[model samples]
Target: MIIAVIDGMGGGIGGQIVNYLRQELPSYFEIYGLGTNSAATSVMLKNHANKGATGENAIVVSVKKANAIIGPLSIIIPNGMMGEVTDKMAAAVCDADAFKILLPISPENFELVGLENKPLMLLIKDAIDLLKKEFNIK
Candidate 1:
């Protein structure tokens, strides 16, 4: 399965998702770090995403080709994050039948840097468990 991690700036949330997936589920999954800008993409690349892209258009184009998408729900909001993640981004993720794994958005995390998406850690494990059970991972 190809999972795309979408993000705008910083990419902390997206990168963390990749990290968890890579460490826990490496059997047949490919993680793509999809960023709306170069900065976001750089962060994800460092986290070891199999592929990376930047810019709204670029992200829309590439993510449409991915199998699944994982990130904060805000990433797909229309004109969101200064247009870094536009409606097109949202469409691409959805049209692909890409199962979405989202991190909840809170004022504290949105305003603070490095606050981390605590729910992501929880969701990743549970999501993987469900996917594994459904697909028979082991």
Candidate 2:
């Protein structure tokens, strides 16, 4: 399956997600690192994503081909990632047919209600668990 991990800024979150998936899941799955910038893409690539792409156009094109899309909730919010995520990128990700597994990591000036303030690592672990359950991974 083609799984896309999207992130921006320092790309820390995407890198961690890629690393966890590589270590925890079988090698049969393909991980695509989609970043708002080259720095982010490089970080995820170093963490062992099978392939990667950067910028709004790349994200718009790749998200459609993914079987699953994983990223912060901000990915679908236009002008997110400190404006690194463009409207077209947000629209494409939202409109994609792939199943979206979004992390509840809200950006500055916004907050998501009904969710406890959990550590980032814990949130990522939950995401991985959800993926495992959905795919029937051992």
What tens-digit string does per-residue lDDT give for candidate 1 at 1-138? 777888876888777777777787765687788888888888888988888878767777776666667777677566666666677777776666666655555322354357455666676676666556654667
Model 2 lDDT, full chain set: 0.94
List, residue by residue over 1-138, the lDDT tens digit for candidate 2: 999999999999999999999988999999999999999999999999999999999999999899889999999999998999899999999999998999999989988999988998988899999998988889
The C-alpha stretches of model 2 lying farther than 4 A from their native spots are none
Candidate 2 TM-score, true structure as reference: 0.97
User: In model 1, what lDDT does residue 97 have?
Assistant: 62
Instruction: Measure candidate 1: CA RMSD.
Output: 4.7
- lDDT leader: 2
Regions more than 4 Å wrong, model 1: 106-120, 130-135
Cα RMSD (angstroms) for every candidate in the order listed? 4.7, 0.8
TM-score of each: 0.77, 0.97
Per-residue lDDT for 101 in model 2? 94
